[model samples]
Target: MKVNRFGRQAIVAGAAVATASMLLAGCTGTSSSPTASADPNATLVFGITADPTQTIPWTTTSEQSVQVLSQIYSPLLTTNKDDQPVANLADLPKVSSDGLTYTFTLKDGLKFSNGSALDSADVKYTYEKIMDPASKASSRSYLASVASIDTPSPTTVVVHLSKPDASFPSGLTAVNTGIVPSDVSVDSLQTTPVGSGPYKWAGRVANESISLERNPDFFGGKPGAAKVEFRIIPDDQSMVSALKTGSVDVAIFDNPVTAKTAVSNKTKSMEAASLQYHVLQLRAASPVLSNVNSRLAIQCAISRQDVIDTAALGSGTVTGPITSPEYRSDPKAQPCAKQDLKKAKEYMQKAGTPDGFTLNVMTSQGLYSTAVDEAQNVQAQLGKVGIKVNVQALDSNAYVQKWLAGDFDAAIAQNAGSADPNTMYARYFTSGGTYNKVAGYSSPELDKLFADGIATTDTAKRKTVYTQLSKELVDNAAWVWLFTPKEYIVLNSSVTGFEARYDADVSTLWKASLS
Candidate 1:
């Protein structure tokens, strides 16, 4: 699955923060010790930009954490590069004609690395854990439609949803709910994930590295490498140095500036459309942003092209209402209006732009590679329209906290992409929706469209409803849809079979060979 996108990370981060304290004891070092030097020919050392906040399934919102756990666990379903559902541990699920029931056939002879048989019981256990409110699994919302699960046999599992959910199958691809042995305690399961995936947990060195050894008995087939090492080197410069010295075979650079530098000898740079976008989120309650004209002025001031050129090195796609380009349809939503200082000033005057009214634009200092740069660009552009802007860089966690709490006037933040329009649109448009916390904006018409869109499985009908919602969102100037960065996956010349994914999930390591 495309696992590395910021949208999913932001959604998961909300739940992760709520349950972080509960995981401290379970995620401490395991009983196992690190093994001696891994044979280079038999191992693939991959460099990740940041350490995972937690290793436990369903408790972490960090994509880096998902990248690590994906190597050690297997989901019932996985996604292709197009974000379409694909069978992984289970065969293609058979959906009922009404679309309310889904039946999955488990692959034969699946077993956890510990040698425990993986069966329908494990699938049941996984969902039950997520459904249990006490477990506080971040995946709980994804399965909220599931009314009940029936395990008819060791190999057959059935799910009955309360209503038709065309997107239900995609939820099965979530790495947070990867199947685990039914007998293990939730506490131990969080720390020592045991699954039937291609790799087994070897050991971890906090803030430094994590190791996974190939599972010889893996159901998918043994991995190409004997072991895999994820070296967590946070700084782009440090990672570039590591790549040059052969300390790591592959490096995932969050900053395009660093990625561009990796296009040289002994390493090749690969790029993919990140299922992530940066946006200027405005709060509806803030006096400066409350008026539609004021919002429109702010939106008209930003030249997305310039922001992309400055922050992404001219390598990202400019965005509009339909942030996911792959999902855009006929009568495409109009892109942001061209920068017009005169028009923006006129709108500001109409909205009674207060004298000395300065908007605080919050952004992440280091976590988001381009947030501060983007904010500065926005500040410069908005200044041309006679609007004073102040950029404040905050810690990533604190930024999300303020965003969720609706405490900031405006901020630049990364958001996730979705295969289904309902998943992304509803959260930002519907009343009390997850992402809708920003702006405290609510639209009855848009909410109705979301309800109708997700309820009908007919593709043509769904498209009409979504297209309408997209138009409504943009007309309101709900946000300034910025740009989607072109992310690069850099690897050593000796590595093979590695491919970059839009979602950025580290699970791609499954097919990779080191030598």
Candidate 2:
């Protein structure tokens, strides 16, 4: 849920890319409007996936599924194209010397699309509403900070953390943490939400589509895309076909390394890695995977290189669920060590299975395919190591629900990229949490490590703590990490000044330019 840190954007749609003449270059193409160099008055039609869980910014963490998600909401802060933490609504993020408190200065003259001035009160209201149990907002974990919010005036607010949380600002920039007007009602907020973003919720066509018009009052300046249209498609292939038929201008696909080259070269559209990265989620609570040995077997048997080569389409590399090797605290840990045939085979036998155990692999049908393909490849590779696997492909929605409910032995999912490694590694490792939790993993040592890391703002100490935490997580084998994907994107040559970030959410709608 945390974004705007390091300018990482979440890719709401699962598989993101493409190019064909009929599919791309049309009078009504995605970039059909006049160029920024010419008229600069053309409408841009950007495509995204289905309905969001909720439009309530405070509650819409993974709302990238809905094209209208972040467009209708604005966070207190946002990461620029460079991925540095910068002021979106509030001024620069400030931390306490002890790292327990945070102070934010609001940007001047920022107004919601509905004309309500965005102020500290709005920030306070939105946070309290999300944190409030009665609100039942699904993504409350995003605001772990803030014992209280003191709004000294309309423009100034101070957030007091229960403990030191140096990474709190990352939460502030998260789409789910977007601030709302203090006066907006739950009913009103749900129906016709407003924000200080690039676009305003013009109207909705119910479950089918969301229509938004650019907000002229945006503090960042008017968006180049005059009018934005987002249509939800439940099927991945259909979404691709829509792009082919020109019904959709952009198709956000999760390409395997092999497919990326084709998708990138094939489509006029480009693929960019949103914050979320691909993964193989092994449920830690399951007796099968709970044993560190079983996890290690799967880690060894399944060719991480094959996954990296075939499924990731060269866009990914081997990594863990919480921490990838690239983002590892200790280079020595080297997440997901090479396949130790003898060790893996020996471990499987010690675990009471001379042959590998069979388990259902739940993956999203409409989302990414790397997990499913990885599962099959893992099945074969594990067979070599004497492990049998049964892959189960489910609807993206069903996969999400059942996997989170601990209904599967193992599942395929993604990290969706994190603004910082804290959100990437530490957040999910917490107990009784599920925003990005994989494998129902929990530990006292992990809790302490995470707590220590979050409480201390010191980079060196935090790194040491995170390094320890990463080792502990790997030892536990909570989730079988697949790889950290290098996202690919193909954009029309005309779309210039576009921002590339790590969060999966759409920041380009506002921050992106035509020229």
Instruction: List all candidate RMSDs to the true structure.
Output: 9.6, 6.6
| Residues 280-322 of candidate 2: C-alpha lDDT, one tens digit per residue | 6777777777777787777666667766554544455455443
Candidate 1 TM-score, true structure as reference: 0.83
Model 1, range 217-242, lDDT digits (tens) per residue? 79887687898898877666777777
What is residue 327's positional error in candidate 1, in angstroms?
Answer: 2.8
TM-score of each: 0.83, 0.83
Question: Number of backbone collisions per candidate, in order?
Answer: 7, 49
| Residue 77's lDDT in candidate 2 | 81
- lDDT (C-alpha) at residue 302 in model 1: 79
